[model samples]
Target: MVKYLDTPGGFVTKAAASLTLDAGCEFGGGVDCGSQYFLGFMAYHRAWFLQDRLALTVGGGAITNPGRYLVLLPPINGTTAASGTPYFTANPGDRYRAWDFQVAADVIPRPFITFRVEFNHRAANVPYFSGPGGVTPPGGNQGAPGSLVDGWSPDLVKTENRLTGALMVKL
Candidate 1:
């Protein structure tokens, strides 16, 4: 679930939480039999615009998940095992945690159109980002259901840096 609340003093608050059943496929699909997966976070960022032309925003947050798959984070994909098996163990204690910081800039060149650029950095105890080769399937059906599989894991990094640019139009 997610919620957004507007408060006094020009401040807004955001929060969210989610749960995944049959986590890691440990013991079938029952709630008692299967492992439980959880993810939760809350963050707030206030936008400051200078004369309605330039805008800046800053925010930070933390995340915890098992093997990066159970979290419903925006613009992030989890790591999967090549053998069609659960990559992470069912133990809830095996979860990994991460913290993120972000800064964004917006240039409101016109009334209806705006340009944005954002920079983000995340640090985790375990590896995260993809390496140079990327995570693509190999050239053969390695016993996967109607698909090919590569018997290799991605080279994950502990720290990740991302830069994004977008053009938004008000309709």
Candidate 2:
């Protein structure tokens, strides 16, 4: 699953984190990949109707947040000791998610251009990754140490929700 932790338009990162939850100088030095901040997302679109002179377009999507249960938040939230190395938790994990939708209305004002206005509710597939790891056997709960690393998408982000209004010139 992926999680956000940045700006509003971007993924929700530790920056968007509630300052009150901060553990302070001793508690992981301001870290909060805290065990309660997981998320996910999905999106799709289509046209509803159109006039005799032009066609119309429409679409929407969702953010899937299973819930957050990370023992770590972000490196930026950490102090000097916090490096690429992640901190450990004493329990299992959880996930988080939220959703947003969108709609669009546009028309061919002339043969060469199509002017449109769009209204949309934007949300993202919160960019986070989680995969159980360790040398233990598949069914061994009491095996050696394991890990769940959280980081950005090595490739493209999962998805997003945003309102975009523009002119299409078919020249």
Most TM-score-accurate candidate? 1
Per-candidate Cα lDDT values, in order, are 0.53, 0.36
C-alpha RMSD of each candidate structure in angstroms: 7.3, 17.4
Candidate 2, backbone clash total? 31
The C-alpha stretches of model 2 lying farther than 4 A from their native spots are 1-45, 48-52, 65-94, 123-164
Top of the candidates by lDDT: 1
Each candidate structure's count of clashing pairs:
0, 31
lDDT of 1 by residue, 31-131 (tens): 32223444545454544344456666677677656534454322112323432333223344455777888888888888798899999988877655555
Off by over 4 Å in 1: 1-39, 66-69, 72-91, 138-151
**lDDT per residue (tens digit) for residues 1-171 in model 2:** 122232333321122111111221112433344433333333333332233224443444333222233223322212122232223222223333434555666666666787777765543344432222322234432212333224421221324345677898886
